[model samples]
Target chain A: MTLEIETGGVQLSTPILPASGTFGWGTELKNLVDYSALGAVVTKGISLHPRKGNPQPRLLEVPCGLINSIGLQNPGVDAFIQNYEKELSALSMPVIVNIFGESPQEYAEVATKLSNCHWVSGLEINLSCPNVHAGGLEFGSNITGVRDVIQAVRNSTNKPLWAKFSHSTHLFHLVEAALEAGSNAVVLLNTLPALAINIKSKQPVLGARRGGLSGPPLKYVALRDVFDVYSRFKCHIVGVGGIIKPEDAVEFILAGARAVEIGTGAMVHPELFIKCRNFMSEYLKNGSYESVENMVGLAHDDQHV
Target chain B: MRDSPTHFQLTITGNEKVGDRFFLLSFENPGVSFRPGQFAMVAISGEPYPLLRRPFAVSRTPEGTLQILYRVVGTGTRLMSYWKKGRKVNVIFPLGNGFEKIQNACILVGGGSGVASMIALARELHSRGTPYLLCVGTKKSGELDPHSSVFQNPPLNVKFATEDGSFGFHGTVLDLAEQHIHSFTCAAVCGPPAMMTAFLERFPDVNAMFSLENHMGCGTGVCLGCAIETRNGMMRVCVDGPVFPGKILLPEHLK
Candidate 1:
């Protein structure tokens, strides 16, 4: 079945993309996955300056999820362009640059530099990374803050703008603000903020004391947020969080997401991209759906079929 | 560089106790050959309680059993201790750069549980007809008991040292190696940081290879969790060299 999707003027061959951070710079998994079958490859958050990230014990395992406070570590935008641009250009697939900054101007600066590079297809403004101490989730938790960042980035470049929002209480308001500020689509949901403790040591498990939760525990919350935003605005959504199986991707699409991004699922299974595609192909044929796009918003209609 | 590693589920053959607080967990060998110091990232549990996989050095018995000698230190290793026969665990194999060929007579010094990796190296060198001396060290004699299968039928000259004078030598393994430093042309040391540091200081100009240990996440180049500041630059312990040259490793005191 044709899984083609048009988001921000870029045509995706399939709706399966690996989430930022989980896929590294896309070169690390080049030998593992079939890149031509993928919609796009989103890179880790690139900031204005290189960061050392958090200390040891940066990740902890909970019951059904992972808690991480990696603190948005990257080699900065200039180094990324100089070092990874040549390799990313050879991917033969759409490359979404996930950009982050301490302020709206910094976000624009990153976007502006990326706009000059011919390899990048879209820009995923990372205003919702909950693990960092500043600038990330802070800009995503409010409506005006979201609009300000998106507007600054929008003014800087003509590239496809995807505002990646968090699973915050004010997420709907933030989504509306992103659309108003000229976002072509919204990447619904970053990891949820959470904490874990080591009883023996009586201390926080993560190095940064708290972290963003991902995996099975985050699936329902992300789906609800996608459904809530999609039912109201009818905007394109790139659903993320705990898409381990093809059934989970189907759940997200039925909830009104046009595409799905695999994060922790890829970490647990490196061959997840091929597995998800195989399952989706079989799913589409068995369900008698002409294409993956036909399955979108199935849950929003009056009839179950 | 080698080809991309395949992640597979291998069933446990047995979890036999080889030493005090140490277990030799064997699994069905996937028929892939690996170097002496290379390791695998083994999942402790399929669930998320221990989300990240734990890295272990690859060891094989004389009977052609692929095994890992692990000590119960943390929750992950402790959970690995309880794994039973017939249980399947996911592992990504043949990771990190292993040791290179030893041209001349070599001395293998292993401190504490570091000796687990030495067993594999010893087996490989013996099969290749390389001359080497094996030195195993621990806190006391009980830590390296005679009942352990790892101590059986060692092909080369084997030496031992203990802190309490209960074994071959009366001091640390580095102290025991001092006498034989001039006899061997090369050395390979794997143990606690202090032991490696002392060995480096004693034989500054001698050629030596070291197997390192660190906390790892992906056991690949991605997570960057196992980064070590080397003499050259920031190097990942997982992908760069879990087995590094003596000169490349930054001294512990300087770190």
Candidate 2:
């Protein structure tokens, strides 16, 4: 019944973790979920300084999805370590800190500072976040920019580096670059760039005018990208986009993702973590699979490979 | 009943058009104990097109049913009206903080859809034998029948106000509450932002509990999309409160 995953030397109890931003700072979900039972707690994007995020109407509901332009609203690295380190450390699972920056040096600085903290299990470098004006999309969309930021953060911390990138034409190149720059794993894909307009008002629905689309609709797109990347690389891939049901998680694993991250799905149902775990465990047992790890990349047989 | 907000398949029992652009939707409650002002995130349709669940106040909890008063404002709500009875929709209930304990002789003032949140509070207060008054205001004379089962069965002392002067009082609920303000020591108000703002401006000294509304995503704290400007900076309306002390809300709105 073991559902362990060893990614970049970090042993996860389960293959399920809360995607960054959707899980908040960990404390917000303390009452709503049992954080200690999950694989890891990936916190919201944290920067060097506190962020006010975008103006009003930061979110909008589109067809089978959510479009949010939160602008990476966070309390900065120092405050996070100061205010939430105790609670995060108290959790039984790993604490993978998701950090973003305006530049490679800033990314390195935040990683360097966080590396000293004992509770943080790893670092998830946000290279493809689409909400912000600077840093996120700029570095995430470029190969060299992705390599530089990942390398900079890689040099700063000995912890596992998980370079999270979005679905782009150069996604595979970016993943290759991340691995070359010392990334232990790569997470794909962040939300797809999308915009919804209010025809009556002749204005955009979201405050930022454009936001990332996450939900059930993003599942197949994420699967295609994960499968394409996994076919060429033996490196660990963490698939995230629109993972709601346990079958979605299984699909990601078969598509070659070592683990799956739940974002909007978890928001809708806080108990989704437990449900996914239960369903996955039952599926593994009934199917007579030795372990969830064994199921990874099974679909990428001779034909796909 | 679960400690955390749990998802339940709610069967639509009734959908009544209570007023212009407003509908009172009743669904089979799965025995979740929720206080007044606490809301639920209801999926309008099973389709992915209306992806996010709409946040609605728990208007009433009678027997095995939960009622929500929703206004047809946007795409989600407009689609909700087309849903037929017995249709099942997903709902995560008992989300966010509800109103705190009200002192005796406190007046409850509601405006428009805000009155929906106060109905449960009034019912709870009535059961405790606490002396309270219900004052409701709407744009026209027939927004809500003060003589309906909701108001009349209990024979609750209800006051009415309308902008057109076709109702009991010829002004806003805040103006109607002025005469009764000296008789009560405290107040509980829920309504449109401007109405609540006006109430607080006039009764600065009175301790009032105001249930504020903001555009929400998750209706849980995770999304952090529903931010309310407070004296202590931006707070999530989903977590920090849909309910806040009048004193805290006044400074920002008053300024």
The C-alpha stretches of model 1 lying farther than 4 A from their native spots are: A129-137, A197-203, A301-305, B1-3, B9-12, B44-50, B61-64, B74-79, B82-89, B104-113, B129-131, B139-147, B151-157, B162-187, B192-208, B246-255
Q: Count the backbone clashes (under 3 Å) in each candidate.
A: 0, 2
| lDDT, candidate 1, at B158 | 76
Candidate achieving the largest lDDT: 2
> Which candidate's DockQ is highest?
2
Per-residue lDDT tens digits for candidate 2, residues A126-224, read 986432445345688888788889889988999999998888887778888999999999988888888999999899987779888899999999999
Kindly report the fnat of each predicted structure, to 2 decimals: 0.23, 0.59
Interface RMSD of 1: 2.8
TM-score of chain A of each: 0.94, 0.95
- CA lDDT of every candidate: 0.81, 0.82
Model 2: clashing residue pairs?
A63-B49, A64-B48
Docking class of 2: medium
